[model samples]
Target: MPVTLAIAGLLFATGSNSARTDVDGGRQEELSGLVSQENRKVDAYDQQVERMQREVDRASRARARNDKVAARAQERSDELGRTVGLGPATGTGVRVTLDDAPRTEIGEGNIPPDYLVVHQQDVQAVVNAMWAGGATAVQVMDQRLISTSAVRCVGNTLLLNGRVYSPPFAVTAVGPTDRIAGSLEREPGIRVYKQYVKTYGLGYEVERLTEVTVPGYRGTLDLQFAESGR
Candidate 1:
């Protein structure tokens, strides 16, 4: 999935070389249109999911009312659901924003173009630091974090949960704000990133929020595994 997403990013970021003389060939604009269209589709699907989930919840509650076993199972499912980020998380925490450095003339000081862009590891560092700081929940862009969630990138754009987002990505977490702030400060990857922020002017900012809510994970939880040959 990650590999496929990376390829999609490449397609969006760089159009066919044989089809055009210029590097981008005005594909950035086309990509923007496609992104907007996909976002609308996602929104529609979310609405459909919400309606179906409400129906399921109502039916579960009805069954639990008359069946002792069903009641116990529903109670257990609710408990586990909260622990696994199936429900919304709300509390005080931090919102960290990362953006690419402004384009500059490639001349003296010999700075690589890569240094000016935010990479996959850069976002992962922040998420991991938040988790290490005891974050109850973390969100990248608008998607809630699950154990299976993967952060990926191609060029300066971010790929999260099958959606592509541009620079100025925001990572929000609900937890102990002070501890998370300290962890962000102490993280080695973040420290190196900060140094680049100082030298190359990359956009890195952390804002401690008094209150924030990370929505429940609405994506599928089914996992696929390979079966061994006998």
Candidate 2:
């Protein structure tokens, strides 16, 4: 009689466990369904926003086309475009490439923590040096530099204009080769970077191009601002 009671207890426990599992699984499915429904709604809303923006842009552009003042404004736009490196430029110049140091055993010295990675100053140093060296037009990666071009770094990657680029950033400029090279050598920031290159295996390369072409700016040049101090 004792053995029979023990077997009956085991069967009852097993049945209870199975029922609990089923209940938990049903709840999980219901939660998943709710999440999926929300995601679908969000997707639909995003599509609606995109369609509205497209319609707005089309309307604005059409108005510009019908206005004589807009046509005259485009003439000045063409001139400003070339001056800001928005128009493609081709010439002989020097190209500078700066890359982060290789991941290896750091050499013995009082090296700062900053030597391990390439910072914005490092990139800016090269760009500024090139401009000072008399670079007619400059480009970071494949994008052309405009009057509004700004070089910025976030973490180890570079943020130029509106795009992000990984290590081994390339800076190309079109102008006198001799002056560009000399400017780079004179830049104090670059000299310090060079010291780390020997210690930490940082990459630095300069190439001279007899003929190279940099594309014009492809982003919006429109400025939107209002007078302050109302």
Candidate 3:
């Protein structure tokens, strides 16, 4: 009787476990489908916004041509656009590339794995140095940097303006190459990164470009919230 009861309990538990697994799997699939559907809707909305913005810009330009005050405002807006990275900048400058140490070079020494990968600070240090060097504009991996741009790192990947990239990361700046190079050499943060580069076989390369154009930013410029200082 005892043996029969034990067998009955085991069968019941097995059946219940199988049913629970099925239900959980179905829920996972349903959630995944919902996420995909939402993503599609977001893409469609973005396309619509871009089309509407182009129409608005065309109307504004037409008005500027017919009114002197509007024309003055348009000229001022153009000047600000160049300063705020809304217009492409072209000049002779340098491009710096940063990459992780070779995978084969890892685990051969007593160094932590973290030391083998590039960090957010490393990228930010380079950017700050470029700005201090008198860069007119800077581009990271094909995207121009604006006042609000933030460089973030996750594991071995870089997150910039809603996009993700993996090393080797390239930063191009439009400026006097001599001043930029000098600043890069003198930066304390870069000095430490170079030390690790030598010890861990991390990749660092700088190339001078005779002519490089840092494209204007295309991302949305809408501010989510603002406060009145008064």
Report the number of the highest-TM-score candidate.
1
* Cα lDDT tens digits for candidate 3, 26-49: 654554454345445545655686
Stretches > 4 Å off in candidate 2: 1-74, 106-113, 222-230
Q: Where does candidate 3 have its weakest 10-residue lDDT segment?
A: 1-10
Candidate 2, residues 67-88: lDDT per residue as tens digits? 8787566657667757877678
Candidate 1, residues 1-230: lDDT per residue as tens digits? Answer: 44344446555554334235556657766666766666566567667878898899999999999999999999999999999999999999999999888766223347886787788899999999999998999999999998877787866677666666788999999999999999999999999999889988899999999999999998757653345799
**Clash pairs of candidate 3?**
none
User: Which is the better candidate, 1 or 3, if ranked by lDDT?
Assistant: 1
What ranges in model 1 sit over 4 Å off? 1-24, 104-110, 224-230
Considering TM-score, where higher is better, how would the candidates rank from best to worst? Answer: 1, 3, 2
TM-score of 1: 0.85
Error of 1 at 203 (Å): 0.6
Q: Highest lDDT among the candidates is held by which one?
A: 1
